[model samples]
Target: MSAPERIPPRSVTTAELLAKGELKVRGQIREASNAVLYCSVSYEGQDAFCVYKPVAGERPLWDFPDGTLAQREVAAYEVSEATGWGLVPPTVLRDGPYGEGMCQLWIESAADSELLALVDDEEPADGWKAIGFAEVGEGRTALLVHADDARLRRLAVLDAVINNADRKGGHLLPEGQDRLYGIDHGVTFNAENKLRTLLWGWAGEPLTGEAVETLTTLRDGLASGGPLATRLAELITAAEVDATRARVDALLASGKHPEPSGEWPAIPWPPV
Candidate 1:
């Protein structure tokens, strides 16, 4: 089967697309724990592509309730939009061929971009920042590296705020110049310190002026019972929403990049 075209699926309202889009499953992602499908959605005489993860296909997790992953993906988009970072692509919780699922806008990353790896011997070349190191196996270690891009730095901040438990190497997509977009936010906002990621590069660095301002704005917005909170409440428990609020406060209080607490796994399993 031919792959779906790399189309930018933004433009129309999410609700309108969800109601009108005719979803045709193109293929399944066998690597995902749950049923993940690439699909073509036609709506209002326009065609777009999306990644769909149905609630019924979700594998049960001990920490999270059953069938909440798809909504969590939508919640991540809400937070991303509220912060004005646009780190996450436009996403919506809509019914698809596999039933209710998260439908996200397709992003076509620049072909030249490479998957960053944490290496030990290699000094970070230009455009790469050394984050931290991990034990590979048999006492061998590797240094975690990331692109030295400001947008990605901002995404690191957003990951902390969301308590993202899975910031894999493959999640960061580079597009148009230095733009970075983050995806696969199914395991977020667990009302616990579940921030497993490879973004420890700025572990002790002070927050950039823009990051502080954006975080401050988000905190205030959530406190005022704003649209972000309303949208999150529809997907997650009230406790989890309150936890997200607390996380924002904690980041602001620290005023610097967070260090791994050693309470949970610092990096996600498989890294990518």
Candidate 2:
């Protein structure tokens, strides 16, 4: 007899599914050296898609300790939530196909949507901001640009506060009409100044009143020894946690977007 047809599970909110899901690895993301998997997570008979990165699959870095990237991913989510920007998707630390690691709800966007795109000999389009120009083949330079939306600006602020070391162009994902999602936050919250990204358009710009207020709230939340601070400690070193607090303080004091200090490369290679 033929096998019975399978049934799909019901859908639920991203937060609800991530909190109680039973993760099952379905396929491997071969492009990533680290063992990243595309997973189907079912919770309370509701289904969700997630990206699972196991601790065991993490590759060691000279600067970052081993097996801590998963923790960093979860920590990034906490920061996103604490800032109330909801930039990072719902992510949790859990045992999965390979081992304990970060399991984040996968955000869906338009198949043809390009969060960051390269343009040549074209004026700035409406609703878009030119970040910089990059060299293409044959001595051609292309303008690198991203959506000039408030949601992305909020993410830039979040990246500054978290001391994100890598914010490649591809990290931004379009959600709804006016929403953007940020991912790949495993290299964040370092003790040193490692802010690298393609969001230079807002450099030196003063923080909006609302942005400053949100950051102030984040600062107070971390200082009060709230859940965010406690969770960060479990994922990263105490020194790194301290550094995070310090970064928040610095941002509040400056009250403006930070500029590249030239200590490290200001942008990630393969900008996209």
Candidate 3:
């Protein structure tokens, strides 16, 4: 006899499904530094695609403590949620076939969205901001630029707060016209100044009024004994949480987009 057809639940949320559903690994994302499993999670037949990064599969980084990348990814999501920007996809820490891991909803990027570009001109055109020059190959150079979009500006602020060490161009997932999502956040929330990103077009510029307001909210939420602080303590070191608070305070005090520290590489290798 044929098996009965499965029926999906009507009220299950993406977060709920990701946190409580059965995870079946479909394949491995071979390009990732750590083991990234492409899986379908189902609860009461409600299924959705997601990326799962198991803690056991995490590679040791000299800068970051071992076996902490998954937690940091979840912590990044928490901070993103507090910003009310939803920049990171719905992510949760849960047990999968490979044990504990971070499960995030898979976002399909719009094929035609162009947020980063390499132009031959010395300066970027209107509506674009230059991120300095890059060596393409064979001693050739091109001007690297990104869109002067509010979404990217907000992301830059978030990256500053989290001390995101890797914000490659490929990490920016443009969803349709109005929305964008960032992925691969396992290297965030470091206690030190390790902000490496491609979104440096607005460096040294004044923060938007909206950004100031959001930072204020973040400051309050990250106060000692506050909910954000408490949640982050569970994921990262206490010192790292304190550093996050300090970064927010610094942004508020400066009231401007942060410039590269010059101590470390401002942009990650292979920007795209």
Find the candidate with the highest lDDT and give its number.
Answer: 3
On residues 1-272, what C-alpha lDDT tens digit does candidate 3 reach at each position?
99999986479889999999999999999988899999999997788999999999998898897347999999999999999999999999999999999999999999899899999999999999999899989999999999999999999999999999999999999999899999999998877899999999999999999999999999999999999999999999989999999999999999999999899889998787
TM-score of each: 0.89, 0.89, 0.95
lDDT of 1 by residue, 1-272 (tens): 99998987568675566546898889987988888898888886677777888988998889877338988988999999999988998888888777888988778887787647666665777778786677889989887788777887899999998889999987888897867899999999998788898887778789999999999999987784777788788988889989999988988998998989988779888887
For residues 181-256, write the lDDT of model 2, one tens digit per residue: 9999998888889899988767888988989999888888787477778878888888888888898888889999
Ten-residue stretch with the least lDDT total in model 2: 109-118
lDDT, model 3: 0.94
TM-score of 1: 0.89
Model 2 clash count equals 0
Checking candidate 3 for backbone clashes, the offending pairs are: none
Candidate 1 residue runs with Cα over 4 Å from true position: 1-11, 118-127, 134-140
Give the lDDT of residue 209 in candidate 2.
92
Candidate 2 regions exceeding 4 Å error are: 1-16, 112-114, 121-126
